[model samples]
Target: MERTGTEPVTARSALGLRLVLAAVYTPLFVLGAVVFSLWAASAGPGSVPSGDGLAVVAGVCAALAVLAAVDLVVVVRRRRRERGGRG
Candidate 1:
């Protein structure tokens, strides 16, 4: 169960936790945004959320997308750096 000191940590393993979390949470966030929009649309004008509410949803989705992109870039660069160092 324990990791031996002889084993080297690669970027994939190092980023695995964050990547998993991001993968799970990001989709849920986007789905929630979509559902919210659909519900708002179906509810008609009186029940619809304000423009600011829609803007907030857009902003959150955008931020999550940016974060995911940055995480991917960091993982890729780390993997490349690790490979370069090993060779």
Candidate 2:
């Protein structure tokens, strides 16, 4: 019954891991997006160099945040279904 490395991951364990990862990353991405966005905005009013790079980074972060959020939602729904709504 020992699992080989090549064995496919079980749905439950995979989903559980995904749930944890999504939960952790969602917040981090959101925070990064916010911070970067603020920096990008501030550059416009300050003497700092062009905010173009910062703005691009912020956009990427925002996209990642949205992706993570979607992953989190999907994982939650799957876990809920796996629990048969009793949990």
Candidate 3:
């Protein structure tokens, strides 16, 4: 297979890796945020005291989710542009 670099690379093909990564991370981050947020909110029992550190974990998760979402949007926009305004 001789390489010539003119095989019509598509947006989906070009950005598949990053798209998959962003999609995966978005849910994971949201899940982490929800779980830690719940834990932080339910900090009114034994062992885990109130205002310990669950909130911080939740915050970080939320922040990561936001960042990942932003990345996802950027990737999607780039893909659309690559696709000649199909979005």
Among the numbered candidates, top TM-score falls to 2
Q: Please report the candidate that would top lDDT against the real structure.
A: 3
Model 2 whole-model lDDT (C-alpha atoms): 0.82
Better of 2 and 3 by lDDT: 3
- Candidate 3: where is the Cα deviation over 4 Å? 1-14
Clash counts for the predictions, in order: 0, 0, 0
Writing each residue's lDDT as its tens digit, candidate 3 over 9-60 gives 4512547788899999999999999999898887875545554588888999
lDDT of each: 0.64, 0.82, 0.84
TM-score of 2: 0.75
- Model 2 lDDT-worst window of ten: 4-13
Which residue pairs in candidate 3 collide? Answer: none
lDDT of 2 by residue, 1-87 (tens): 367677566723688788888899989988998998888888865546558888888889889989999999988887787778833
Off by over 4 Å in 2: 1-12, 44-49
Query: What would the C-alpha RMSD of candidate 1 be, to one decimal place?
Result: 6.6
